[model samples]
Target: MGEVKAIKGADWKLEIGGLTELMGEKEGPALLFDRIQDYPPGFRILTNVFRTQKRAALSLRLDPNLSGIDLLNGWRMKLRTFKPVPVSVVEGGPLFENSMSDGEIDLERFPAPIWHEMDGGRYLGTGCCVITRDPESGRVNVGTYRCMIQGKNKVSVKVNKGKGGRIAMEKYHQAGQPCPVAISLGQEPSLFLASMSPLSPEINEYEYAGWLQGAPFPVVPGPLTGLPLPATAEIVLEGEIPPLESKDLPKEGPFGEWYGYFADTTVGEVPLMVVKKVYYRNDPIILGVPPLKPPNHYVSVPLGAAALWDQLEQAGIPDVKGVWGFVYSAQTGPFTVIAIRQRYAGHSKQALLVASGARAGAYGGKFMVVVDDDVDITNPYDVIWAMSTRCNVREGVDLVKGVWTSPAEPAIPPASRSPRGYTMDRVLIDACRPYQWLDEFPQVNVFPKEYKRDLEKKWKL
Candidate 1:
């Protein structure tokens, strides 16, 4: 397989206008470009980093057949043996190839796509991480947040409630000081993966990225924010968030979000980032990832599945053979299916309990199905078979309502603005033949291996 190409700013163009326009029409790995009217021509915009299972496997250095949980397990194992090294400043690097400062800084020059027609403005940063630090604890946090370009040197940043950046911003707000921040764009795939992972509080994503990379990530402290960033990153934007009351208000977001539709109209005052500096290597590459409906390339199903498995494991769920997030159901976003080797009478129910509370399963999922070890959770056909024959809706279905939910989810009623927890229904199917009734269920008809081989050898048709 050919190695993936790295995008640089000097040779890239920003052509597409909105996220819907760019993502809705593309069928496969899409390279969007036409060049901005003012910026240099021939620049490229790359999206859909892991468009196929093969690509996702390659990104994690695993076989395509491996489950998402398998990849996470592999990384966790490697992490045990890895240590991160700080990035040293080199004499010259690609990020330094182009420099923009003061009057030269013009965010509009780049073709930053307006992700959705309803979105407030052009979003410059999606596939990027904003690094910040707690003023008191000195611990660092890296999080994925949407940023909109407001001017040549300003941006409107949305940090979701309860996120790490929001907490950091609050600390600064209380003290009446600007919160320092650094945004890193166009980083390595592992770094991007780590940024999206749910790490423990105060755990630097750079170190996690280093663990994933099998070496320390190169880092350079931002001049203004002093936040550490990937040295090999295509672009870096250093800035600070002013106090909430002092910040300017911007109309933000009708943007189509991960929920498969334009998010509900919401108006709020967000932070305004005054860019202190912008850094890029020669021909720096800017990355854009647009979220559309399910079955889309950027769908969060795989990640959600992996997270579910992790959560189950953490919760001490036993005999788990595998876990899968069903892509077909729109209500659940992803239906979690688990196959477990039965060790007790209610083993399947135990598995369902763990799954329902599992991080990925709890947040986005609405349905849960548990099957005997004989069924392959990864294969939808096999799971459906168990559900059809072995599951009893009245007896097997377990529903738990009033669970915690997020505002991002559309299922919540309008009256409930606070996080609402809905009931989860779990079904356990006994696919295995009854232990005491071997004679009750007749054996399936099948030709012997030798006979099958001979038949194939003799038949030319």
Candidate 2:
């Protein structure tokens, strides 16, 4: 189902990363690299696991034939049925086929790639899951945070402020205790998806993964940290993050982000984890999901838009047909589009306003557009055509300032950014025809969909 190739360690990073970028451009198959320049024959790395709709659907246990907004809408309905499926604790599994402790630890034994030329160091945890528990409620949270190797037994984790893992770690540190952590380098695809989802703090990711897969996820207690580790994981690292001042923490990141830019690198800003134990299968496969530039995303479908659609409906905007995003991240990013069937004079504008500020569409957002239901929101051409024909420049666009955004946004001036948080302006566009003049508006020159389908059937074209 994918390509397997051998690579030399001297030029491994560049070759692998270059190949991944090229394949992403063309929507290519998964890549499996083995026989490294210095590593054993069976040691390997896998990438592009969810780059195709078929693969993404299969990973989430959904029907593979679904595509576009239909697929996302299916997931949205599934989300409504979510219930916590507690994980199963197994005593042992393939994850413990081999083990290493303090004196024998050497992270370099496994190949960590420099996915981008500008990356400050080798990142071993791009696709990995960082597991932490809240000290106050004992609630476990699994998140996908970048981890870069600093030493044989140390990896600095970039847990951004306001993330569940970061909040949990800060709580432990405030109590003068070390925050226990477990890093799973590779595991079932459902687990990885749940780790990166925008789940609420009260929901445990392990349970969410179980719900996604329709079965209880199996995990084992870490030998040292007692944190849950994926029983079938390829590699697992047990560690703890102790309270330390900014000066004492190691430098972390200038890595390429999903937003298609290298975020600012900081010195002594990230938290450092001291690994105490390592467990792995006989021949581990590291899941490498390095962020590529815009138009080449890690996940093919606009999954985030599904949540936004749900929020728009909940906000009381009626006749919502679909939602799609372009150049997106975990949530919506630079451009988000909403399709709705106009029911009243102000229906379209109401959707534009609510979607631009809704919890699911607000973060990392730049442009928000609302189009009529007839336009294919997933197609850029269709969306742009609606804007050109229906919207009056003077009446359609509104800019909202000081909106919520991430620090990775390159548009934010360095002088304007504060250690506290980041914000940016969002432009909301109404592309639907003016409902006030509904009966007087010009009709689109196009064949009806049902009539076109009938012609296609009769002509056999």
Candidate 3:
């Protein structure tokens, strides 16, 4: 349950060999490989930090039962009293255990796993954050865009349209300057979570990570780009994005996404990075968690749901009990379900409208379901039952068409790609007992607590 602070370089081979075996056996522990082939033996790598709910809870220093939303809300509440104390520079950290210069860089040496067969290449920066700057504002940005190892020093970066990274790149493009960027490969779990957190466009994620960690994160200004990065990061790559050219298209994904299928794409392309420098600790351990179908604990949907809840609450939506973004649907397309304690007539409808209009909802979500507070939104069966029995589809469903959609979404039609959103048919189910005639509905049967306990004891024989 404790974090591995550092590992010795000489012991790296044993650690990697052991970790590789453990990963194959599905054993539990954060694998920190001190070394991999070609790199100095002391470089560190981490994996399986978010493999289970318990692990995620532990990482956040929360009770096991606390959901990501609960943790986020608790952290948000502390924000009023918390302050970020940025670390400018320090004497040394694990990341500086070994450093490589321009000519010494070799990306293939790291144990960057070939996670999924369909992935375009070994993703070197899946669990990392790409730090960039807004050329005009001089404001820094951090994004969780995935990166694929392209060469000895280069990696392909996928910055989705409308994402902060892409916008920053656009700013650089407009200025006719190569975008200054730094890619951080590994660091504290809090930083990774903050990277994925849906913060205000103006909020620096580094500051947010500091708030969550209960202290300002230790950061070092990137050597070349000057972007703040996790000081303890395993690997840091300082680079620039060249003005995007028409012929720079690199075949990108066929990676199995959260939707349980290979993400559909005929022309998969993203911006490419020509590495100017690559730095690492001696034996660097690259973290890689390939997206699969639902139940991938590190999957983006659940995290997105937590962000959605925060956004909905911020929008003054009342009685919003919970939110669940279907991980299975994210790969297929974005679908979300929200649970609320309906306060009055049309409350559910109002909730639906606000959620659908939210920034995250408009970006990827295709379907939304609003259910009464009693229905556990996380339980698909409960949500389905509510939709089936309580909803009168014709009366309850509301559709909004021509909504804004992200270009990365596969379901979006080409003709409607001009900031256009598709229709979202919202089904509001009043799972609560009918207010006018509560007694008319049949009472649900359940075993008495004492009787169930007795039965369980007797069945042991």
Q: Give each model's whole-structure lDDT.
A: 0.64, 0.87, 0.65
- Between candidates 1 and 3, which one is better according to TM-score? 3
TM-score of model 1 relative to the true fold? 0.80
Write one digit per residue (lDDT tens) for candidate 2, span 1-461. Answer: 54333443433566778777877788878778777656777778888888888888878778989888888888888899999999999999999999999989998888888889889888999899999988889888999989999999999998887789999999999999999999999989889999988776788899999999999999988889888899999999998998988889877779898889998587877899999899999889999899899889888887888889889999999999999998887787879999999999889889988987887788889999999899998899999999889888899999998888877788888798665677889999999888888779888899898999999999998
Write the residue-wise lDDT of candidate 3 on 1-461 in tens digits.
45343344422323443443344335355556554554665445666666555566666556656654465454335444546555446545777767666778887766665555555556777788889988878877788877877788788777776678889998888878888888888767777776766566887878878777777678876677777767888788888888866466566665555455555342425777878777776556566444545554453226556556767888888878887766532221366788887666667777778877777566656677887776767777877887787776666776776565545455555565432223333333344444444458666476767898898899973
Pairs of residues at least 3 apart in sequence or in different chains that clash in candidate 3: 9-42, 42-283, 43-282, 43-283, 43-284, 44-285, 45-285, 259-331, 402-421, 403-421
The alpha-carbon RMSD values of the candidates against the true structure, listed in the order shown, are 5.0, 1.9, 5.0
Q: Which has the higher lDDT value, candidate number 2 or candidate number 3? A: 2
Task: Give the range of the ten consecutive residues with the poorest summed lDDT in model 1.
Answer: 6-15
CA lDDT, candidate 1, residue 251: 60
- Candidate 1, residues 107-127: lDDT per residue as tens digits? 776667766555667788877
Q: Order of candidates by lDDT, top first?
A: 2, 3, 1
Give all TM-scores, in the order shown.
0.80, 0.95, 0.82
Query: Which candidate's lDDT is highest?
Result: 2
